[model samples]
Target: MNITFPHLGNTYIAAKVLFEGLGVDYTIPPLSSKKTLEIGCLYSPDDVCLPFKIMIGNYVESIQRGADTVLITGSCGPCRFGEYCELQKKILLSLDKDIKFIVIDEPAKIGIREFLNRLSMVAKDSKLSKAKKIKALSMAVKTINLIDNIEKECRFFAGFEKNKGEFARLLKTVKLEAIEAKGAEKTLKVLEEHYEKLKKIEIDNFKNPIKIGIIGEIYTIIDPLSNMYIEDILMNLGVSTRRTLYPSWWVKNTVLSGLKINFSKIYKESKEYLGLCIGGHARECIGEAILNYKHGFDGLIQIFPVGCMPEIVSKAILPDIERRYGIPILSLVVDEMTGEAGYYTRVEAFLDLIEGRKKLCI
Candidate 1:
């Protein structure tokens, strides 16, 4: 089967490594863009969350390019993500797309046997042996972790770079070039070279620039198009930024969650505000805001799609966190109708507010 999946930040990189390592024929959906969102909106129900619409667009685009199977991770939730696969399947069928879907749920939720059965379906078409397949999975995880580290380094150092925009430029170039590499080993090598390049980029360590932490619903914060590339804007504005959630973090967390293990600092900091997993990354959002403040970040920016239930709850609690911790926060809600001018204006004002606070501190 020629398989496809939705874009979630650098996940396409790991997925490419996995599929190629398995020797399976696969298609990477075109990167999410305005046209992709428009196509999704045209076919999706008006009230569905933004991620669903974007994913629908990805599937439609992939199908047109000859993909017949879609792979998606499943969630059991008080949030709406759990219902997406069922709804999306019907939506595609109505459009006469007729694509097969494989939803990978947690083994604990769907049972280990069922999870493996679904996994085998993907590996079944591969020419690789069982041992090789296992090795490929391990490689993919390492690749994802490396990419995330590269991103974290880029975003955090953009403000301190001696050559403006060097980190941002290198980051874009690395991702584009890595995708063209023909095998997992080459891809890993490409990333390693890029990581080294990032480390060697000149930076002014003494420069004190605005430092902001981004926290919000997982999909919107991770996907550039969905959130209007907020992190890119912050980088271009010479703001150092940090985000606690990334695809690698999600992967690591999911694996350890069954053992009731979590990031202890996050759990402790957010305990006073939100004590339970309200589905989505709401708990992470609250905990990260506190964590970043403790780390001395000047401010925080929380972005989520309009009508995102989990983030809506986090947004309500954020003002109190800000008051208690003395950290300023700006919350941006985006959807198909989000206007660039208004969004940028608010970000600029937030920066000004933080700068003013800095001056007062001095």
Candidate 2:
């Protein structure tokens, strides 16, 4: 099984660690770029969401390098994501590309036995003993959590760094080094070393900076290409940002959800506005808006792909939260046709508004 999967932020890094540790033949698609988006647009339905098109590009790129199996998580919800794997499989097959898909869905949805069976398919090629395989899984989990923590710190601290661009540079360097490192162990070491370096960077806690919370569709918010690297843009502007969704957070949430346990306090906060899932992360978006407001965020930016139903709903509800708490919220919708100049202009304007609001308080 020459496995390949769609990129979800830094999830690709952890996937590399997992596949390398398993000693399985796998291919990591080149990072998402304009070329990737263009290719995806060429083949995908014009109306499909942005993420679906980008994923098609990722699969085609990997297939050129000899990947025959695709690994993706499944969702059995009202959201269109649940239909992605099936539609994507058909799309590829229609083009006469022979490929297989292994979808790892929640144990509660697909049942625990089926979940393990699907997972076993990926490791069946590995010669490692059962214990070693388990160890590899553990290592991958640790790698993801460690990297996410590192990224979170870098983003939040970017606003306070005494040396401009220090956090951004360190973040880029660490990701490059970690990806270049051979095995999971070495990758973990690279992260650990840089984390120590991160602590040594000078930051001024007294320097108050604009802080924003990012909320909206999971894929668009987490994947850099999808959101046009909004987080990086914020870092460059010396703005502190926070978001509740990360690949690591998703992993824990999925597990807790399967166990019928509520893992996030955000859900409780959102209940007053949006009481049900309504598909996608709309509930979480509303919840995060309230949570960020209570935590004293200067503003909130909600990003989602164009035509996304759930976020369209959240966009409407956000005004209520803004009025109720006097927090500013900006909603940006993106698709293949979105212009870079216009998008950046809106972001900059939002920042200007936040700064003006902050000055008024002082």
Per-model lDDT: 0.92, 0.92
lDDT of 2 by residue, 282-353 (tens): 998998999999998999999999999889999989999988898988989999888899999999999999
Against the true structure, candidate 2 reaches a TM-score of: 0.98
Clashes of each: 0, 0
TM-score of each: 0.98, 0.98
Error of 1 at 200 (Å): 0.8
TM-score of 1: 0.98
**lDDT tens per residue, model 1, 60-109:** 99999999998999889789998899999999888765678899988888
